[model samples]
Target: MPSDLLAPALPTAQLPAHLVASSTRYVETGLRGAANTVRAYAGDWKRFTSWCALHRLESLPAPVEALAGFLTELADAGKKVATIQRHAAAIAKAHALAGHDSPTADKKVKVLLKGIAREKKTRIKQAAAFTLASFKRTIRSIDVSTPTGLRNRALLLLGFTGAFRRSELEALNIEDLAFDEEGLVVSLDKSKTNQLGQAEEKAIFYSPDPALCPIRSLQAWLRVLDRTEGCVFVSLRKHQHLTTRRMTTKYINLIVQQYLGAPYTAHSLRASFVTVSKLHGADDSKVMNQTKHKTSAMIRRYTRLDNVRQHNAAKELGL
Candidate 1:
């Protein structure tokens, strides 16, 4: 029997100082924020370093001019402004930690940063949310009578219901799921934000509607799955169990493309949760808890209030 595919859970030990410091000096002391934020910043900073190296930049501690030039190059390459800004923020933090102020703070660097920020703001479009209709369309397109179909249905529902990111879905293990009277408890060992704030390990519980619950699909998967003791989701080849390696994030992307046709990613499921929750009057704090968002401002972006309010107002006007 192929062992279940699941990434080994990362221990809750503090990460190496050098590894963290490579991204930012703050990591030397420790990340005092969200785990997801830290990981993103780390990745962004590394990419900036790689870009700097490719351009033969004299130093990792280059001036704001170099940073500005890089941002321009990214924009010219057609990267979204938001993505470019994220790179800028990550590089800026690393530079600042290395005893340099933001190049933007310099009169010359300031001008370039301002230009990029303004230009990018106009170009960045907010992401769209996944609606119930969209979800149904994607699932209905799948032929769920087969094992692969069963796995895909369970995967889609779990992704939506748990608001799971691609990486999180891939890391899921059968042991992580626990059922109680309240609902299901999803024990995520490592997430985008796993190492943020105190760096302690914690599990998030997911409570889905019982009638149209994703867990029911998960249960159906468990019944037919060969290796029930390992990862919750596995790849099937001709109804034969393949390696028990957990599904990759890229596979999740491919799955999204197959079902939704395009312009949708795993993160959209998380955003969808926030959008729908807000539309249904879920409080900011409650939604934040579900989405694991640190701030209200970030949550506001996910909740498309203007559209919801407009639709509600039209109904009242009719009454």
Candidate 2:
């Protein structure tokens, strides 16, 4: 086995009895949430600790006023409201774990939650999405003969077909992709819902049309890359084997920017999928199921009015 393929051994450490019990409960109750959420929480806590140390605070068991002061400092430093809220949540969770009732928890939660609501309202102010014709034109503008073009085509197709978020696209592995006579099946262990709502594991299948240009391009790229053993996508290296190194969300964003120009991103592919699917008369329920969305409210954001209007206009004019 390659050195990179070897799984690292678990570390030996004396953990608190409550921590051990918490781990056991998480495993037994099947409440082991997304690893990304846990990592984010850990990062937020570390930032809080750093802030506390800078202020010469002895312990996190400090008064609620201290936490509020820290938040004020963050605000004064020009941190976004969302970032401040994340910091507050992290500090509250840590205080709760330490058997201290956080004095600022409720206030911080309210402020942060309001900021989130406002952000959603801001997104609603943006113009509606483009039509299928525009989307097709965008894809046709790319030259699919080169290796980078081939990879971008596959990335765009899979992202649109799966309605995948940037993180979900990055986490995809070769073993997770299953090809059948019907079409392609993508099994994802983690997604935005898993990270945010802590829901059950779910996967989505994309049945690409044989005649579709993007699908054909993806099929050709797969054959040329010959990466059937590991991750479906990889860096532009000559190695045939898939190493443990995985693509990051940052890389996916960079790829999208390089190929499609500004304002278009990995997320735009997902938006295009939802917009196009809805324009074709796909019901809200069916679209939600394919997108693996838990709620119609969340799915509605993808189905924009401009897409529907353009599609209807085309049909009415027989264009």
Candidate 3:
């Protein structure tokens, strides 16, 4: 019989060697999920397998009862609803990849997830958004005489103007930038939202003040880099010598915190852009154009004007 024909109707471990190898190859490359997502799922699956091993239970084609126990244990361990949800998704994908039915589809598992969410009553935290005035002030305060200063200023300005996620910023390249008389256009090959390698562009306009102009700051930084290609942002040496290596997402966050100071993460740049634009009367569509957000609901979520006075219609009641 052919190797595929000899594939056993058993757990993943008991499958024929050739069948297992083929399945492993498909799992690694045939999935539609993003690289980060695939890595996360792999991690979740590993944890689940470890848990199963400790309990002397089968991991592949996991029983619904075992899944319930696993999720319950996770919830009892104070895992967040979002984290638990991701774990469930990981388990589901693992079973699907192995040609087995996902026990996560069980009604009991669904109810368990719902109950966990209800009992936890937890919410996702939003990044702190600075005012437009504060942003301008911070931008102006950055001394751009040095190479480090030039790069930092450019990174911050572009990240805010483009409403770019840290990953997007990290993935940016010199070839992706195009300058025009009006402003600059950044072309992205892919992003967190755009996993299919769609052609997307973000426009950053020139500021009246040279000090706050993203194009000017980027130009200065690029002059320091002295190359027409490679990553837009990169690592620097102790003496501020630039390296060819791209900046990591964690390093980007650290840089943001370094310059913007406490409580402001890299996400704050994107959030503040949304909040400030909304406050200045930009509608969801306008904001979406820059942020490349697919939904108005996400735009609303990103708008972090915490004060009631920010956008209250109560004042217009004409009492």
Top candidate on lDDT is: 3
Query: Once superposed on the true structure, which residue ranges of model 1 sit more than 4 Å away at CA?
Result: 1-26, 29-57, 96-107, 194-211, 226-229, 238-240, 305-311, 317-319
Model 1 scores a C-alpha lDDT of 0.66
- Highest TM-score among the candidates is held by which one? 3
Tell me the TM-score of model 2: 0.71
Q: Which pairs in model 3 have colliding backbones?
A: none
Candidate 2, 1-319: lDDT as tens digits: 1112112222215767657656544432232235554567677777766777888874356566567667777766766666777677666655555546665556764674465546544233332345556656666666766766677778876676677888887777767766655556666675766544443332334435433444466677677767666666666655334344666777887887675666676777777777888768888887786678868887677766653445565657765
What is candidate 1's TM-score against the reference? 0.73
User: For model 1, how does the per-residue alpha-carbon lDDT over 1-319 read when each residue is reduced to its tens digit?
Assistant: 0011111223225767555434443433342244445567777777776777888884345766677778788878877767877777666555544445566456776676567767766645754577777787677677777777778888887877676777778878887777765557776665656554232222334435433457677787888865547877777666456557677777887887677767777667777777777777788888766666789988887765445453375766765
Misplaced by over 4 Å in model 2 are 1-33, 96-100, 108-131, 195-214, 237-245, 302-319
Ranking of models by lDDT = 3, 1, 2
What ordering of candidates by TM-score runs from best to worst?
A: 3, 1, 2
Error of 1 at 272 (Å): 1.5
lDDT of 3 by residue, 259-302 (tens): 78878999999999999999888989999999999999999999
* Each prediction's whole-model lDDT (CA): 0.66, 0.62, 0.87
